[model samples]
Target: MTFRECQRCGTCCEKGGPALHEADLGLLEHIPMSDVVCLRRGEMAFDPRTQSLQPLSAELMKIRGKDRGWECIYFLSQAKTCSIYSHRPLECRSLFCADTAAVLEAMAVPTLSRQDMVPQESALWDCITDHENNFPVGQALRLAKAETDFAGSICSELDDLIRREIHFRQVLADRVQAADRDLWAYLGRPLWLVLLPLNPIFSRYEHA
Candidate 1:
């Protein structure tokens, strides 16, 4: 098989910005929060074991990118360059879709330790903390629980917590923008998405 060399075509960026790695924490303050988003515990993730996108049991901070289209936020479609190319995440630099070995090896690299993050003394950060703590990834079975039962009136407590987080992210999103806003964007999605609970993370590292 002839291996194709990368041509900087931005197709990978369409898969979304690289997940934040431990090495990429340094770029946090340099990049606008408008360009980042956190993946909470309850959100679905692919379980290599099950070959399914199951909800994880912990929080993960990642760069915000296009939802349905898979475009990285920093990717400039017009010019075909990353707006933050010089400081792109480690995965962004190491990933080479055409190179199977490289792609497999890169998968083992861990994302930025949430422990490395120094929470700012602000309401937004507090809100984020609240969201993670309130609707924790306490049960992997949450993925299997009928949504109507897990996060519905049957679980009004969780439902209310989810609503608060939605409002929190929406209100905070308006505050952070590309206009030199220092914090990461707090773009919350639908309420149902917010209510899924996660199991504990596989790692031993303490999170912020």
Candidate 2:
């Protein structure tokens, strides 16, 4: 199946649940935190139990106990669409059904595998790798040079850059959180438990 062949039944959209990334927060600047609602509390922050990070809140928690697992406030069942579609989140944009997956993979964009990613810690490594590779080399060099002569102005810009970088880091963290959960389920084992026993064996093999 391919993307072109997709019937756009929106089945995946209806059944599919994708969380937001840090970079996606920029889109929420116009949206007040008061109006936004969190779907899953666990989805909004780093879950130590699952070792995953949650998405950001568009609006602060208004109704008590309203924000908990799976269902999102932004999801509108009537329209059969996300209320915040433009700013929806990396997970939402990247999610695909079988047909979409085949199309994306053919285009050379990496597609998620149920085996590769878990719902909790989805695509974190890829996010980190992308951020690392996407850093602006020219801008960094210019900032470094400008700091020496125009410390005050450059400092302000540097602060903004730092914030942006931090946002990107958050995106990576979110991905890790999702992937970690997925991996745990996939391996059918806790990460620590599996790695502790396997590390030494793999190390020995590497040396050989």
Candidate 3:
């Protein structure tokens, strides 16, 4: 078997950082939301490999990679080093883009969950899961991203989606003070971030 040795060329880092999977959840206690983002199912991203819109199957907590245009937030471009090299995620440790077999195999494993949690953390986790399931933003988001022919339906879905977000925020805020921000994190990136990609579709509908 052959393996690729990294040349410290920084090409991989520029491609972006590894996602935060089940094994990486513990790092959240130390990593701030500014550096990491949770991607909900609603965000429609183009998948180059699939040549289609890549819809998420589950909630994905990923590192914010575009701070420097698709570069990892922890990437020190000038020095060609990762700022948080010592504490990188497991996916990062297993990855070697030149020989992607390991990373591909790792992805087949189920996402990790907290085996043991204290009462407070457990409560929050439960609420997050419940809200995510109950709200079902995927359909609304998909409709909102559709072509102009679905303008009326898109409008309706967007309204419903926003209302659901507001209601969920209320539920979270009731559980703890200042949880509105946490709501965004739990839903993945900021609401505006999700909206950015769909803005063009929205504009076309409005004008038409």
Candidate 4:
């Protein structure tokens, strides 16, 4: 299997399934943050939604599931293409098909097996590392990562810590939005509030 072998079936591209990454955020410069969808603290949502974000409690919220999670608002269904293809995020570009996997393995760098690919964690890490590199949506990534890692029991005690931080940041964002009557004002601030308290742990990853 190889990249050239891809049929461009678009089976993997439809329905807003893939999570956004830091590089995706960078590629999405032209798209307003309001237009992109994201999962925050295990909840699915887009900007301007009237209700709380949807909790991803079931497998249906996954890419392998029927609904395939949230779709990108800019994705064009008719052409089976991304409306913002050129500027699409890194995660989108990084996604490999069966052919791509075979090619990579043939070249000697065995990609992780499918069972090892935790889409949520990978997306969360991409967001965090990229946000730290100065992307605007990193705050959301921080919240998402905290929620994801906490839920996985990787460090169970950190679950409450992360949740508390997420709640605090959400409250702060709400206040900022109320005062400024704008959502962008709250974007970067959440990361600041959440990361400040975890400076000891985060500092280790700063150089990573």
| Number of the top TM-score candidate | 3
Q: Rank the candidates by TM-score, best first.
A: 3, 1, 4, 2
TM-score of each: 0.65, 0.29, 0.66, 0.35
Model 4 lDDT at residue 91: 42
Model 3 — TM-score against the truth? 0.66
Q: Rank the candidates by lDDT, best first.
A: 3, 1, 4, 2
**CA error at residue 178 for candidate 3, angstroms:** 6.2
Candidate 4 local lDDT, 58-106, one digit each (tens): 1111112122234545556677776667775444565556534432333
Give the range of the ten consecutive residues with the poorest summed lDDT in model 2.
Answer: 58-67
Q: How accurate is candidate 4 locally (lDDT)?
A: 0.39
Top candidate on lDDT is 3
Model 2 lDDT at residue 112: 30
Provide the RMSD of all predictions against the true structure, rounded to 1 decimal. Answer: 8.0, 19.3, 5.4, 14.9
Write model 1 residue lDDT over 1-208, tens digit each, in one string: 5567777777877767767767777788787655676565566654433657776565566776664233787898877888888888777777777765664455566765344564567665576567556545443235335445432233545445445545654555566542212233443333343332332221111110
* CA lDDT, every model vs. true structure: 0.56, 0.38, 0.61, 0.39
In candidate 3, which residue pairs get closer than 3 Å at backbone N, Cα or C atoms, i.e. clash? 22-112, 38-188
lDDT of 2 by residue, 1-208 (tens): 4554434455544433343334345544643333332231112333322456544222112211122223444566666666677766555565555434532433233323222222435553444335435443334434544565442343556446544654554454375564322222122112122222212321221211
Candidate 1 Cα outliers beyond 4 Å, as residue runs:
46-52, 67-69, 120-126, 137-145, 148-159, 167-208
Per-residue CA lDDT of model 3 for 1-208, tens digit only, reads 5556977878877776666677776776777655665567656654434658777666566666763245788888889988888788877787776887787666665653222222435776777666666656575565556636653335665656656656666666776775454444554533433554655443332211
Off by over 4 Å in 4: 1-3, 15-17, 44-69, 99-208
